[model samples]
Target: MPERFPGCITRVRGISAGHFTDTRRPTGCSVVIARPGAVGGVDVRGAAPGTRETDLLAPANTVSVVHAVLLSGGSAWGLDAAGGVMRWLHGQGLGLDAGSPETPARVPIVPAAVLFDLHVGADPARQPPVCPDAAAGYAACQASLERGALAEGNVGAGAGATVGKMFGMGCAMKGGIGAASVTLDGVTVGALVAVNALGDVRDAQGRLLAGARTADGAALRDTARALLAGEPPAALLAGRNTTIGVIATDAALDKAGACRLATAGHDGLARAINPVHTCADGDTLFALATGQAPAPGPGLNVLAALAAEAVARACVNAVRAAASVQAGALWLPACAQELPVAP
Candidate 1:
């Protein structure tokens, strides 16, 4: 967190993590809406995806200020959890018809994404179906908001996140949600990333900060180098990765500008991730304006640039805040240890 990024709007109210797979594995991360909804846009760069409600964010859509954002494991099946969020938001009366009496109705539009975390090698027949704990986590976030306190690390959507999947899960490292904020001029831009990429993790300088070795200290192969040699093998074709994130700013943006800002924010992902936005990876970025503060500049390009830079800082901070963990036999190192934080 930097002094430049401080602001009264767009505060992270609460964070909740839980396990929602019948596999009894951790794979839930839920973020509650702390700020009033503003304009929203989404940019999906990956070929294979398990996304929910991305179309609603398009410029043609009518909804704004989604009640919640869900990031979880269980692949495409996890999209069902949004129903729970909708039910909760309906209860809060935070939907579109907050005060409309003529046609009072509620729609707690929620956008969600999922990562592939099937119990590989285990009995597929014995594995349980997707659970509703992700929704429970959302409820917990709402509760945490009332009580106060937001926990970080290996929780929520980061529960099953792993990085460096170029050689597959056996060689990947554990990853989780990472947050970073930066202040430029007088506005604050904040980023929260659910890091589950299929490539090696790096810092702003492009160094291989982490995920180059195996859990047992064995040297790992470089997926980037392999791609240069030839096409990826069939075994690596699984939808094993994606990185989902949200960029929050007080600056106002129209639908097109917000979309452009979301695309520009990909630079931050490129800066922090090697071989991003691949066919097997569904990398998406969402630009959100809470309307608490107005865009400082008169032009959309300037505001877009600011949003992009903020996104980049957030991506960098995410890698910096990630913790090292051992999944199965893989030993992932903490981002803080791999790349020292700036002074």
Candidate 2:
């Protein structure tokens, strides 16, 4: 994989990404594993969010090592996957060293979050919930244990993802997972994101890439504009949209720096996803450092900048990699087929 893309995320030592999906229902989960345990941090922006172990990633948190980070579907229920991950790590004897005769010497720390993908596929009443659980989480981890090229788009937590629902599902489009990596000198940064937002998706150049469309599917439409007009084609929802992801690097960094890096990582989401972090979304990002490279003398400023770029690139890649699908009253247009949205 490195021979083709020297900047591949898997090139980082002791890092692997895996995804598990139930395509029948359009819901799944993605796992990012740092077997050596990387310093981790998180930043949450959306008003309605679902998460697990985010507090541990805070600067004030006592724990310093995070064994894995899980991004999944099925709203709060998806958090169940974390337990499976913890058990897997514990079985492997990987985690914080507690060093006690009574209790296990090591306990793995696995933080997780989920996006709402229930609105897609068939009606909510008729379908069984597809949120990833202990079994699914364990399966994804076992698959991820192997280091290799990671797959993106229409997988993991993004399987049932859709965007531009400000005007409701009728105007929404399909969203998926995207990934990108960068290497410079001795620093390497990579990002993976599941693109699911309540607004349109865009490119760094500010061009409309994929989004809501007119009734006839003649052209794409601006979701914000429709909302600003003081009317919506469909009723707005409370918490069915979000964009979740992780940014990782080999540089040495503390929990605080990781927190700051995660904070800065939002710029990438803001850059690529129009009208982000709305009340209905659960936008979140996690940053981790493997400490393979020397710690920056400053606040890891250069790597932070690169982290933002990596995220932006990943966002674009997600949109580009997504395949169009029909969900309820909406029809998503793949990036490859995206024509100019109506002005």
Candidate 3:
């Protein structure tokens, strides 16, 4: 059996996670709530990302902390979910002081990123496109406070996620959410990712975990090999795919350190997913430091390295935990359904 960490982002102090899955369609949103606030930073690698409040996460920005981070599956429209998170935080009186004596108020800072799952499991005849809204975000925030541990696969933002789309949806496989954590020198670093890439996911040994399928959908096509063999890239829907996630730590890191950590998190994606950061994919990562551990002297680099490993493990866990989805004429298979482990 492969090595398993069995750890999640919620293990980090001051962090909580939750999900709100819509039953009408396979679409939903996920929330990572940081009580009080945490120093935040972000890195966007994909060319076609849809995000909100990312500019404020820059190291030079005046606002140094964020209240929460949201990941949703409604494409650009999913960003609205962040507003609901903000509302919830405001109700709890958790945010930056932005008002005076007469109108004292706290403004919650919630940065968000989105993935494209709009084309999956929708009935155009029955209703309009099923996308997550502010209500979904509010519900997710409530779930975070109620559910202590994070749940993975086929839930939240990853509910309708798919991967290995180099040949389009017909040959793609189901993707979902995953989480992992690692402890180093008394500090805990964790990651939670939604795997909705435009390429195949691989194991540490470069073995295909889940990806594009054969024409008959009986086996993996080794998407990288096919493209290297002169297969023309399919005309996939523009900006219709992405992999977004958050990395949380209890280490005492400043805004600049947090930004660097976010960049390092992308290394895990490159290691586990082939052909990442493409024009059609929107890959974004956010980092939060709750400052519960001792300030790093030279151990920051090592901490970042652990974050990368956790991210890679989380990527594998995403697909491995996913269950296949079949909606009338549409069928998206999961790693377990199509590639079972040997008993």
lDDT (Cα atoms) of all candidates against the true structure: 0.61, 0.79, 0.89
When summed lDDT is taken over every stretch of 10 residues in candidate 1, the lowest stretch is 1-10
Model 3, residue 318: C-alpha shift (Å): 0.7
lDDT string for model 1 (1-343, tens) is 2221222113522222222223355566555453345567778887777888889888877765555566666677666666766676667666666546786676766777776655322234564654435465455445534533333446666666777777556656666666665555555556667777887666555556545344343554455665677846336775778887776665666776667777877877887787788888888787776545533633556666655666555555555555676545545665555433211
In model 2, which range of ten residues has the least summed lDDT?
1-10
- In model 1, the runs with Cα more than 4 Å from the true position are 1-23, 32-34, 98-103, 119-125, 130-134, 143-150, 212-216, 219-222, 229-234, 294-299, 329-343
What lDDT tens digits, residue by residue, belong to model 3 across residues 213-300?
8777878888888898898878976689999999999988889999989999999999999989999998999999998766452377
- Supply candidate 2's per-residue lDDT for 73: 86
Query: Can you tell me which runs of candidate 3 are displaced by over 4 Å?
Result: 1-4, 126-128, 294-298, 338-343
- Residue-level lDDT for 1 in candidate 3: 33
Model 2 lDDT on a 0 to 1 scale: 0.79
What TM-score does each of the candidates earn? 0.81, 0.91, 0.95
How far does residue 180 in candidate 1 sit from its true spot (Å)? 1.2
- 1 or 2, greater by lDDT: 2
